[model samples]
Target: MDRVFSFQASGVCINTQHHLDALCVYFSDRDQLDSLEFYSDLEASLKSAVLLPDCVVMIASRKFCEDIKEYWSNDVLKASFVTRGERSGKPFIKYYYLYCWETSGLVEVFSHCADADVKPCFNLSICDLVQQGLYHLVKENNVVQIAPVGHLFKHPSGTRNNIFIQARELAKTEPELCFVGRSISLAFGFERFAKLSVVYIDSMGIYHFVQEALSFCKVDARIHSFHSYDEMRKLTPPPIEHLIVISASTSGGMARDLRNDQGFSDSRILTLIDKSDSDRSGKVLIALESVDKNIFDFEADNFETEIELVGEHFSSKAKPPRAVTLGRPHTPPKLLKFLKEFGRDGLNSLNEIIDGQPKVLSLVTEKVSRNKVFLKWLEEEVSWNITVAIDTVICTDDLGSIEIANTVADLISTHKVGSARPTVCVYRNVDWSSVSNATGVLVVTAVARDGGLLREISRDLRENLNSEINCPRHYLTAVGLPQSKETWSRLKQFLERNASERLYGFSEWLVLPIGSDRQSNHWSDLAALAKTSQVVEVESSVVSKSVVDASLDLVSDAIRKGFNGFLPKTDGSDLALSSGFIYFGDVFKDDLESALHATSYLAIASALQKARDIDDVANQLRSTGYESVILSPECFLRFNDNILHACILRGCRKGELDYSSSPHHSKLMGEFLLKVFSRHQLPYGAAAVEFAAALATQRLKLKKNDQERLVGKVVNSLKDEPSALLGLLLMVDLPRVSMLSIK
Candidate 1:
């Protein structure tokens, strides 16, 4: 009775183009019966090669051993080796041999290996396989020194069997520090890796092990040690990303408790063994049974999207991030109007203020008009009161919310709304002790969807965590969705009934009306506007009739197809309040209409600003018969100086808006756009422009006989500017173009 099993080999360290070409040649020569395979990137190629069955892996670099170790599961008979050439003193490469057998052709594979020139390690206790032929490194009569590395491999019992057999040179520096903790560096973006919290549970030397691993990877992050679940929870915030729990001799109940009650996502928690005594025991089975489930079966995206590199040695430096546009991409009609009234020099001065230059609006625009427009809009839309005292401002840890909160804080300071500038803190990361004595709290979020997180914040602030807060002026600022409004109302009622009779404040200027099916007519109405709108007056430039018509048509088509840039959640909507950005889905259609209108411009610019690539929007538009959107005077000047000052302030503070590096800013841009689009009424500035236009149209119709005289009088009043004169003619001619030229 002999054992027979199907065999396969997977390899890493094949990171270069040369290695790929060599591996392809080697596999082809062996008659593995495969043509050239194509992959999108090197990471994709490496992943496919690692998963392929009946494959021969030629791993060349020890740097990639950490990646290969991730594939080591319970069913696989995995062996790690430290091998050196005959003339070399120290081991040059670390090899991991992982193979699982099915009762099909194990005998034939072993026979092939025996007849072959270089044998791979089949049983670590017996022999070591030299992976030298594929890349042609071996010469005549070269004997390689191969030693079994045992401590790295963990058994089910979590005990180290070869405690006395010490390979001191390799043990201290190579196996112990190179495998487990080094994975995180290549697994995620360097920015995330830098900030991640690494907590290891009840493992001796694991702290130093992880530190050394990170040092080897050329990165650093906060690392904490914990013994029990209670001890881990005392870390202020339990690990949201990485929790390393060491498996001891006996399978502990911690894994079960973490999965069931500790609110830890499976992908965030990783279990490791510090020492394994025997390699032949039921390691994988015991792990599966003891951990209650196979811990390795976590979310695939945790490994896929987060991995910045497959091999750290060959990875290139990330490109510099592009500038983020805080406002709409297209020029607004108001900016054109401003330029017509005041020249580019005046416009430049206004921009200087938005650019965070220490300039006053006294020279830019009339204080009376600017204050009247912006202050009225702010009071109506944001519910700002000069009299109400706000003790602290607690905002969701999102870029948009933070920006809005900071702006609101500035306004409070200007008006002296409180005794001092209220302390602004992010809710999730806020220190409870810092705000324990505060009596008033204002929760500001960009958008409130179902109010789940809001409820949590409310509970913690009002009842659970800080019950002594007694201020009646607690308020919330958000763009309330259909269900969120109801949830907030219920919460308010519950708080009022259970605690005090004081009225709570919630300001949502643009609460969208919910339909029978929980869908809002807001987007639908915008779609209708896109369909009927005949003219696209952008800047003071004359846009051709066909371009405007085609732009509108494409926008209508895209709306019918659903906002293609956004992916719907389980609720059948694109916006996810948790991430504060709409998930990037498909990009089949380009939003051309955004180029001509402020509202659409704001939406598309926000969408693209949050996009993974800034040029994606521009490229898509160009392919679809529209030019790439660019910032113009109207983008900021369309609104008053005050409005632009608040939104674009951070653009100056942080140097420039780089959404790629700061994903939080991208999320914030999405949130800001969500607030803009979700509004029931147009922004105050746009609404006023439309109102004035309608009034002028009505006056012209009334004085039919005196129309020529009235027009001449208007022309005489603005005789200095010819651009404004020509814009007036095109503005009135738009209706005629849609009727005659469109047909």
Candidate 2:
């Protein structure tokens, strides 16, 4: 058996020679340094090399597998390369690309040797390397600037510093925090405090940065944060005389509240601004000298300059006061295009295989990693496009689609595109007056089958905007679409309107078009349809079976009383509770929505009455032509109720993650959810609050702090209602309520 070791050394490499020199110093203490050899020509090295087996081979510049058009052979032992770091887009170099080579000996060795026996050489993360590189850059570069929107700290030469400028922008609109926390550590008499907590409101964008900044300042105090005033009121400790409240910007609402509620004096609180204004009358103000920008003139890049010129050109033409201005349709990146195709092909491939999620995900991750494209598109691209003004609107009705739309809107607001914030609302409920003067409109959907709903949306949108002289840029975006070309054609025709211009409309899909018509209805939509569609009288025996379960009696009773006591549906749809416990019978012929809803309810009712397992219930739903959107992690998050969430999780355990023509199969969603939540991903505002509730009640073994971090403000709003959680768990096919933790 061969013992291979892997280590990562990430830092900026000026050129090829610089990278080699860095590698030599990085591997100075390793035994492998004695036999390590570098090769630029991969083909020559593979064919001509016949040296010692102990040698660690390296190939540079091009990706090894791509250059050779094949993966490594069985004889190869180990491979290393200098590649880009995960986060930093600068001239980064990562050491040891491949820890172990594909070899016949290793395959056999793996059968006998467990993973626990083979210890890794190093455990340094890419983030650690990025920080190291940033530290080096701060020392080397005399002139640096943080991009206004992206919050990237970088050299004037455009080389990235790999440090995020979190507090400078997210907290305020005035002069951004130019100096790093370390620079400000000695300023504003911050070092005078022997022990003081740095306090601020917690947000997904600014919380981590606050801690990082405090640590960078070499402060020794505990950091305190709250999501809102309510959280602050309930959870805040009694008044601490030495506490020093801090704000990155001049905004002092949190500071003011802390003063009034916790009795912190105005002199104790500090705001990093040049001067305190009337709005921040009571707080202390601190300022640092502006850095010298003479060495690096702050000028907009060509791309930004071009966008501005285009906007000016468009504005030059005569237009109506409320006319929608057309912003240029930015071309999608090639990497994103490749991902779409890869996703489409992968989806098609999954349809032909069973239990292939692990293999499929492994393949996708490997392929993506090979190209060194770390998948954080929303954080990177979408955030970069946010505008400060209200220039766009994302319209969607599907709860899953609502999440995506909300993500886009939040990113725009978090990172001003060009100082424009986008709005997200249901197409039916969209306030025309609010969005009428907007620059662009986007119609989004989770999935589109035959394109009927899309066409309906397009027609409605066109009608709404008919009063305007010029149409703004509009796009039809979807997570998934039908595999059929005919379906796509119909959609294009509706948007294009018969051999004319595109009418300021375009279509962009997150995944490749490879969904089936059977999977058209969204799961949330199905649930809504079941809850509101006309109810028919069922036999008393059927009702008796459901009533005997005892767990669902309260829910049934609540439904009978029009959900008076229970919380209103999160989607803002009214529930017309029927007089009796209605369950659909056979011979139900209706639209796809009604059909799927009926089948889903019937399946659950049958499972409950017959005391069958979830699998049996799932099978019944699938056999009855019940199909809905394959809940992605983004979609699975739509299920606020523990019952539906458990159903989704049960589907995940069955290796069903991809879009299915039938119900109860989607392992990908589970994996995605675990990955997303593990990273503490959030959509922002009310949407994030809803998602947090779903995550909190799902019994997923998440830590208390993690749950609080996911949604600090919303958790307080959820009263200590153990009875509600207990009732929800009991009414469905889930483990006993005792096993679940009450948030």
Maximum-TM-score candidate: 1
* Per-residue C-alpha lDDT of model 2 across residues 160-185, encoded as one tens digit per residue: 32222223342221111212232233
- Which pairs clash in the backbone of model 1? 5-106, 74-284, 119-129, 120-129, 121-129, 159-277, 160-276, 160-277, 161-277, 324-657
Residue-by-residue lDDT tens digits, candidate 1, 314-405: 11123222232333332222322222222222222211232233211112322211333333454544444423567678887666567666
In model 2, the runs with Cα more than 4 Å from the true position are: 1-180, 183-186, 194-210, 230-241, 246-263, 272-518, 522-743
- What TM-score does structure 1 among the candidates reach? 0.22
Model 2 poorest ten-residue lDDT run: 104-113
